[model samples]
Target chain A: MAELLRTHPLEAWAAALAELPDEVRITPEPFVAMVDVRVPAAASEGLAVRGTPLPTAPNTWTPTADGRMVWLGPDEWLLTSTGTVPHLLEEELRDQLRPVGGTAVDVSAQRIGLRISGTRAREVLAKGCSIDLHPRAFPAGRSAQTTLGQAGVVLLSLGEEGFAVLVRSSFAGYLASWLLDAGLEYVPLG
Target chain B: MQLIACPWCGPREEVEFTYGGQAHVPYPDDPAALSDEQWAHYVFFRDNTKGRFAERWNHSAGCRRWFNAVRDTTSYRFQRVYRVDDPKPVTP
Candidate 1:
């Protein structure tokens, strides 16, 4: 059996972090596994394991005991969770959806996570992206994939004006730099 | 500063989407069986209507899904946005 190695992309950022200004804070959340699930709309099965169906609706995610099931399309979804066996989700979901001709693919290494929070969190995000970001419009459990800076990212609401933004590993550095610049005005000087 | 609605993600900024050319054009059943004139019509022609035109828009930055939308070309206002899987809306 081959053992896959996990890497830390935010190592330098974590090392330099000392204190965040009162207005906003950016935290790198590492080690979450992501899986993409797809089923043809005309398939016999509706993407389910046991009785729990993968979310069919758009822009919504359903929390399951295993992970969060995020709807990606009419017949597609992404399962995300934090654990060691994130790869197992691909196998497990494949077994469950296979009989119905659905597909499951592991995309854990393709993405990286960042958490942004504080009083100016929404304001900071609004600087480079446009997703409303208002609490009433996008409450918790709401997730969306949008462009941030020049990279494609998935934004999930963690409620209370906090968000978890997932960007591709290759673009992570650029986005982090972009975000720091966007937040410069909000961070108070010493 | 136009807002485009994605059937699933709701209304988002126009920048979040990529415009796909005219929608609802059916693919020729037998492309090899068509004349040059018919082939040209299939490939190069589009309505480009000033009033209402049905076309495709991708929530490229949002849901990453392709959907069909009907909008007024002059005003750039979407009258309806529907899922790709849904039947195309009847044009008025």
Candidate 2:
């Protein structure tokens, strides 16, 4: 059998990110294990991980030992973690949800993660995003599934002027290019 | 641009939502018993009210949930928004 290798969706954009100025930073997140979960409201307690319960409120996320659990809908959530194998995470999630009549599906490849942070991060996103990026509107831990540069993405607000974007693998390159282009104004002239 | 209030995700931009046509169109209880004309009416015909109208909308780019709203088509102002299962509010 030929050697199997995994590749990042934004591997080609490394140089573009490296060229960004200090005021504007955009970097592809490390490989993350993501799982889509659906559970009944009554049995949501079974979905806890490392003492962190699933966030039941709308458009919110809770930090866990590894990553975080983001509420996607009334009964749906997206569990993300770092440094864990995709299959292993899915298997464990499935086993944990089986008895609760819930479901866990591996969606690690469905999206590629990117972190955009800097003083101008919100401004870079404001170019294409329709949502209000003001600190008062989208504070830390708030997550929204919306469009960015015509590509669908799960956007998470991380602290001041930092954001985590999870976009479909097919649209990853497009979003990266859009981000870089939008951040051009912030890049210092050489 | 309009701001639509999603039942779960609060208010978001209109660009994030997709029109789902007239609301309160329940599925026929007995589809096999309907005449051709009746079936066509059920599937195609809809009220084009000039005033307040109840319509379905899908938050495609947000929560991805379908919800119903009452809006004045002429003014393009949303009166109220409610869940799919909730009863429609009286628009006076």
Candidate 3:
């Protein structure tokens, strides 16, 4: 049987990283097991992942033993973990939430992660993003589903000018191009 | 771009939202009992109020939840935003 290998979507864009200044960095994250969770708002209080409660507040995230749970909507969340197997997490979540009229779906392949951090990290992101990136307005621990250029992305603040941009796999190239082009202004001619 | 307040995600750019037309258009209790004209009206008619129009807006790109909003069609200012099940509030 032919071997099946999981590949990173931005593997081809690794060379583009050279154009960005050292102060601004964008690195593609390794494959993460992501599960889309849907539970009743009232019942969510009883749901826990490795003893870590899901974040009930909008646009917030709570850390788990392996990863974190990000709030997507009033009754929706994205559970991302790098340490666990995707199907196992999905099954575990499904069994736990089934009693509460909820569902869990394995969406690990739906999107890819990119970590952008450094002094000018916010500046590069601001070029194509419209949301106020000020620390007071969008402090660390906050996340927002907004647009970067024309691509829809989930921006997670990682403190001290660091952020995680999660975009659909299909739009990864466009976003990488946009970020690189935006970062070029910081690169010196020499 | 305008800022549309999502009831769940708070205010986000207007580009993240898609217009959902008039709000409070409930489905008929008895669809089979309705006359042809009433059925057509239910499917096609919507109030084009000039001021303080109550409408539905979907935060398509943001939280992806649908909410209701009351805005002045003339001034293009959103008076208030409420949840889908919440009762509409009086707007100026």
lDDT of 3 by residue, A1-190 (tens): 1122687789889888755778889898878889999999998875675578888889987668878788999899999988778888899989988988989999988989999998999888888888888889888889999999999999998788499988999999888888888888888888
Query: Model 2, A117-182: lDDT tens per residue?
Result: 988898899999888988899899999998999999999999875999999999999998999899
Q: Give the alpha carbon lDDT tens digit for every residue of B1-92 in model 3.
A: 68888998888888889999999999999999999999999999999898899999999998989899999999899889999999989865
Highest-DockQ candidate: 3
Candidate lDDT (C-alpha), each: 0.79, 0.87, 0.87
Docking level of model 3: high
Candidate 3: residue pairs that collide: none
Candidate 1 vs candidate 3: the DockQ winner is 3
Cα error of candidate 3 at position A99, Å: 1.6
Interface RMSD of 2: 0.9
Worst 10 residues of 3 chain A by lDDT: A1-10
| Number of the candidate with higher TM-score, 1 or 2 | 2
CA RMSD of all predictions: 3.0, 2.6, 2.3
Instruction: List the candidate 2 regions with Cα displacement exceeding 4 Å.
Output: A1-4, A45-50
lDDT of candidate 1 over A1-190, digit per residue (tens) = 2244766677666643325575777888766667888888677235465356666667777777645677777777777766536668678878988877888899988888888998898998888887788999889978888888889888888897498888988888888888888888766677
TM of each candidate vs. truth: 0.87, 0.94, 0.96
